[model samples]
Target chain A: MKYSMEDIARFAEGDMDGDERAEFEKVLQADIDLKSGLASYQNIHSSLKMKLSNDDKDKDFKQTLDEVSADYFKQKSKVIPITRYLAWTSAIAAVFVLFLIWSPWQKDLYRQYADTEMIAMVERGENSAALDMQQAANAFNKKDFSVAKATLENVIGAEPGNATARYYYAISLIETGDGAKARIFFSELYKGTSVFKYDAAFYTALSFIKEKNTKSAIVWLRKIPADAAKYDESRELLNKLK
Target chain B: MLKKLHEDHRYIEALLHNDKKVVQEIYAKFAGKIKRYIINNSGSESDAADILQEALIDIYQQARHKAFQLTCPFEPFLLLVCKRKWLNELKKKSVLQVTNIDDALLTIGEDVFADAELLEKQEAEAKHFEQMFEKLGERCKEIISESLKGDAQEMVAEKLGVTYGYLRKKKSECMAALIQLINKN
Candidate 1:
């Protein structure tokens, strides 16, 4: 009816033969105290085993997070490779073109044209809609009307309600030789609810800059908020208008 | 291997100090073994990933103090350390709560203290298993890995490109051979 401590330890370890294990269970059935002791031993052993097991799991999880983080960095670095390749190609192209043009006057003109084209290329290179709109604004500054208009349209295509893109797109049009089309786009950009409302108003005035309308540029520049980051630049450009 | 593990201790220390490359190397190095240990225990694939990461951190701490003197190969010491950590976590979760904290702490007896020395012996057992695994042909390793997926004989057989009947027989024979090899140690 009773089981020994040695029998209990062996059973807990699961080391006993099947017949002995069955016999020990039968003995445990008859004795409550023996059953309790066996249960305690089994539970403790199981708990330790479980603890060891979870420890293994936690270690594994940390390793996985590390792996995932590494993967993220690898993916980010992959994006930079194409960008670097394009830059190198452009540098090589510039060097080759420079060697072909021997006249100083022709080379200087070519260099200026290349500089403008490179700026246009960089502006068009930005894939982000917001960045495209910013680049469109830069092209408008350089008086590259057609490229600026096309880039702004691309930006607005991605973000239909982008007031800044619309305003810049309109300005590019008006300067490039489409006053009527510019007016409609500018009117729509101004009417819309947008973060670039002030820019929209300012560009409305600049649309007339193509017609040598210094009076309108001054009015629009003055309408720009004094607190806006671009207000100073607008003021300087407005001063040059007269 | 122990020497390599001890050397990796420096790498692990660098990881703890936020060296990104070393952390990546450590992750690549031990992730599989840690995953196996977790999967062998009562945990999911995701749990395995979690356990390995924390264990590495613990090892990192030990390495920082130069306390993780590798007397055995990295895998077993890592397995043991992680096992201990998981057991502690299971206790906290009370998933299979048997004894309370007081009784559990009190149960840390002389034998438990002897575990420090037994670690090296356990490492020998692990190395023995590793040696046996290496001795096994590639097909045997594949069979074991497939069999471990679950005991659905038909499914395992289909996955392993064998008939169910042959698969079962091969599995039993392989398992028996593996047991004998382990027993010989």
Candidate 2:
């Protein structure tokens, strides 16, 4: 005899009276389909209950996991052991001392002032652009500049007016040793009215500094207004350059 | 038969409680190896982070719902889980040229493999169940969700402005419908 879903549900939920439940159990022993249906129902029922009870806690756990994961990857990319540094320092100590004395101001000024930390890309919504922007931000923040450059290129192609993307793309270009191309984008951003205006100007100067163009570096640094975002850093760089 | 819980069960408990310090230790200790494995397998560091995080969340869900106990070292168990997940991800992306790792190198016990497989199965079922639940009709969704709140049936019925009998009847039908949906898939 085929039983209805209600009968299966009642039996699974323990809602059936003793006699009805006994009769259902007798059928359940004989009916394979009914038993499977009851099992599925019970599984779903329990899973739903677990989900309802722990959804908020699950979200909290995911948040904590994301935080720790980001920090782990970030530190992995950035930190160098002191032993490794000391090994390299000893190997190159004499040559470095000679170069440092020969050109004290010619030290890697780009490395000194190029803040490669990309601004946090706020996910405005679930759109593709926001997701791409986020991926670019993650790659950039993790110092994976090649991946960042490629993703940012696509983002720039899709949204030409995204100054954030433009700014970071330029930085990634510089990071990947294409400072010439980076300077072009940085120059464009510096002349625009985006929030990255003076910030772009500062990086443009750093790109020039990276190329050892002290003259162009000084030119770009002087363009940053005193009230601009990179004004203090730019002035310090300028002082050293002068 | 109840299996003996390993000392590493503390890691599972830490996940259940969202203990940041312990979770951070898990990352600090295990993340580098996983990251290296992923990078060697045509995957990026970002992919490694995602896979590791997902594996942990899967373990967390299994522990929360199924009383999953760690009966082996957490390192090998987590590595196996993350490796399986990354393999699945690579398959999904249709990425060729995967460098497969020898399972023998992991030195995972038979029981740990079985437990990881069971946890993966349960995680898939939970996801599929959630998808099937979404396909339920509006009234069915509301009734099932409300009824599962562990409230007294009469209270739930009153809150929904329905008779207790109606609530029970509708909840059963809704669950039946959900089961049918899941089976159809």
Highest DockQ: which candidate? 2
The best candidate by lDDT is 2
Q: What does the lDDT read for residue B117 in candidate 1?
A: 42
- What is the fnat score of candidate 2? 0.52
Q: Taking the tens digit of each residue's C-alpha lDDT, what string does model 2 give over B8-105? A: 99999999999977887788678878887998899887788888988998788778877889888888889989988988998999987777577444
Model 2 chain B worst lDDT window (10 residues): B99-108
* Model 1 agreement with the true structure over B39-156: per-residue lDDT tens digits: 4556544565556555565454334322344433444455555666666667777767323323223544443333334443343343455566556677876675565443476888
Model 2's CAPRI class?
incorrect
lDDT for each residue of candidate 2 in A124-189, tens digit (9 for 90 to 100): 233465567778877886789999899988877876756667888999999999998988898887
- Candidate 1: segments with Cα more than 4 A from true spot: A1-144, A147-159, A162-168, A190-196, A240-242, B1-185
Assess candidate 2 and give its TM-score to the true structure.
0.57
Q: On a 0 to 100 scale, what is the lDDT of residue B32 in model 1?
A: 50
Candidate 2 scores a C-alpha RMSD against the true structure in Å of 16.0
